[model samples]
Target: MGANDIFGVPGDYNLQFLDHITHRQDLKWTGNANELNASYMADGYAREKGFAAFVTTFGVGELSAINGLAGSIAEHVPVLEIVGAPTNNVQNNGSLVHHTFGDHKFDRFEKAHRQLGIKSARLDGEHAIDQINDVAQYIYETKKPAYIILPTNLVEMEVNKSLKDSIPNLFFNKEMNSENSFEQIKSSINNIENPVIVMGHEVDRFNVFNDIKSFSSNNNIPVLDLGLGKGNIDESFSNFVGTYNGQISDESVNKYVANADTVVLIGAKLTDSVTGGFTQQFNEQNTIVLNYENANIYGKSVDKDYNFKTIMTYLSKTKLDLSLPSIKNADNVSEIKPSNNKLTQSFYDKAISQFTSADNTIVAEQGTSFFGLASQKLPKGAKFFGQPLWGSIGYAFPAALGNQIANKNRRIVLSTGEGSLQLTIQELGLAFREKLNPVMFVIDNSGYTVERVIHGMNEPYNDVPNLNYKLMPKAFGAKEDEYDFIEASTENELFDAIFKAKEEKDKLVLIQVNMEMKDVPEQLAKTAKAFADQNK
Candidate 1:
């Protein structure tokens, strides 16, 4: 079994661990003949996947290939990692070895891996062989990219017992709602007049979106989803206050949350994205944060606090103190309409028309897609998933595959650049094998559109080789009848093709959108320029 099929980490780690990181998962082991670890073969796999991959010890100047690997893995996707370690017992004998970097080298590796938040472990001691199976199971269950170091001596050790207890759980620990915690939360809620709920990824992690929504409704509090929590509630819901991550750019939504008298932040880190560098006009004294760890009422400092579930339930049962009028008649929201740029606006309109269903989910990148696509409104319940923290190119494809597997019925829309798609092209195979019926919308302009916009690159490196994206499905082994190929060069064809694909079911569609690198939304264009100038 390969990495995907490996039920536990022990089986997968033994096969691929302590080897050069392969760009393509297939290269790890494809059940094929002529399996040689040649440099050309490894490089071919890397280039095909649009990432840098090298042998375990291939150094490219001061920065080795492992350096590049560390940087790439930091962008949110979980990875399975393995490293070479010196035998614990033999290291005391003072032997100079090239195979092992040094004593405590794994510590440095751990620090580097922490940046990516990928879990890691060492397979070195006498118990190392015995514990690997449980560690492997933990990695598979969590979907987190992990690392397991293999010691030179222990690699040959007999794996006899299962070490299940040593395997760490990657999932967050929810705080218990004790009687004291509940009382503290109830008192805090009762003292507030206008309360706003700030929700974030914790809602998704705990699978408590519906519970939180119900709690908010019963308490008559408007919910402002932090950027990470953008799709917690359906966007069209009357109580929805809009995205608090400054990117939403709605003045009314911003003002409402910023001016709240009492902010009940549940499962949200009131981080920079939600607070705009903490410059928003909010009352620190009345701000309450209920996280998985602990609850704290902020007033210059923490005042009253408790556990997350306690406060949510307490607020739900209490008499709502918010004086704000019903937001159902809210007409102050700035319209996301067309500008003088007819071509760009129309392209967005057509793209929006394609995924008109509530189940449609769009995974976008920080490239021109985020700037251009966010302008177009999604269907009532459609989600826009992006790598806001890292803004990495290749994340969307693989992460989308994982998410699609999680929610197979939803129409997953991947709006990304031609360059970005190259990062994880191997995911196409995974999607094909899994029969994920997502619309692969390629904004094919044959260049790094986002980079050029921000840096004004006149270099040859900015351009990319043109790819025949329309043939992606067939190339990846999808049957002809199981897919729809739609290529549109103009606005009319684009609109028609998008609608047609939406009408068709039980088929994967590739809509090769002929967009220009220069056709960026004006607001985004300005922001990019301002950001560039400020840095310069």
Candidate 2:
């Protein structure tokens, strides 16, 4: 038994197996001291791997943490998980038990697993022990997570040959359909003079980040990253354009996209976030979406694409002569300038100038801050993480903590909204518990700015109780030596706090910037109007 070998429940098997697994060093363990920590250990493991973490429980205390885990996973980190189990003995005895509301003890785990793409299974009965080893092997091999049932009786069950032989068997089979989607893609590429390649998560999922860089270098194709795909490529690439989002009003990339006869989207999902809810102009007929699960050629959605690697390999070998070097070497590229709001830019610039390092990762929350921060230019190697798809508030604080845990050496800056900050503010205690260093910058305007922009003064009563944003770190139990608090009502104060936070590595800081609910991004405003009108 190895690291991966320790499965079912933390106490179900001995820790000896943890020493045998070659890759067990990477697992995050939530100790058996309590159920929450045990669950977090599993979550931390999934998060470190860049996969989603999930948990659902019918148990009382465990239920609160699991509810928090879903949004945390949905926004900051996407991990797969399932966890709901009541002792089968209680149910079998036909006694009035706590989790007897459902058919199975772990049904909540199954329900939540289905919501995401995660695969889930159960552990029950004496014969169910026969399957625990197989499930553990599946979790190890697939990099997907699982929630297992550990009855009180089975928690002490010894390892058996039935379990040992149940190690999962995995197979890889590929059958190419030569019917040819390539010809259509080729025709689209040839017809366009300025072709752009929009890269997304699929590239990273396929572990083709290097392949993408190489292909882009050889092909001289300009690259654009969709939402949540910011870190997919090196930001310093010559052909790289700014991120595409509704909050981004710049039309340079959109103009290039609209004019281009061929636009190759690699590993991108053309969902609402990436396409501004598909309101942004795009020539679907001339576009090619190359993804792991599917492909789009000349705007036709194909259920599947020849594997991403296979397509890239084929393109490299094809001797098709095409010269669009001008698109590659276009002497004039647009620069992402800070917005006209001098104060917002001043605060953002203060943070960026103070903490511009390759090791810094910015976590942006959706809402007003999303637009304000998106306009600021980040230094090379500084990655940005946000919850643009779900557009949920309060995700940045926890997500940043998660990212900080995953990359402890790097400094994390969280630019978030006051409204959303309240959602996961409780998680700040978790950050303090782990001693995770993430400086939070709250854009405090006293209300939901993003919601107001969409619906104007009627604002829909979107407001929360006032919070002492600057004192949050201390409130979450950070000692004087471990926490720094800064409030910025003016430009100089903001920059000073940012500089101090950036300079200090050992402490978690909270920089609260007083802001006004004015000057929303034009594009985001337009999107909001459309959204409101549609519902009306």
Best candidate (score: lDDT): 2
Evaluate residue 183 in candidate 1 and report its C-alpha lDDT on the 0 to 100 scale. Answer: 63
- Candidate 1: which pairs clash? 9-136, 9-137, 78-145, 79-145, 79-146, 81-146, 81-147, 285-299
lDDT of 1: 0.55
Residue range 41-127, candidate 1, lDDT tens digits? 222122112221222321111122233334333322233434444455555574554433545233455555555565656555646
Worst 10 residues of 2 by lDDT: 5-14
Candidate 2 per-residue lDDT over residues 1-536, each given as its tens digit: 12331111222222233233224465543222233333343333334344533333444434444543443334333333334445566646655556445453435545654475444455666567546555555544343444444445444456665644544342222446533666655655666667777777656544566666665666676777776566555677666766665334457667656666677888766656556646655566667888765677775765444555667655654444467563443434333333334455334544553456788877777766565555444567877656666564565666566567666888788888788878667667767777877778887776887788666555548676888766777777778788888887666676677779877788888888777666454555665666676668
Instruction: Name the 10 consecutive residues with the lowest summed lDDT in model 1.
Output: 31-40
In candidate 1, position 439 carries an lDDT of 77
TM-score list, all predictions: 0.71, 0.79
For model 2, what is the error of residue 379's alpha carbon versus the real structure, in angstroms, after optimal superposition? Answer: 2.9
Clashes of each: 8, 10
Q: State which candidate has the highest TM-score.
A: 2
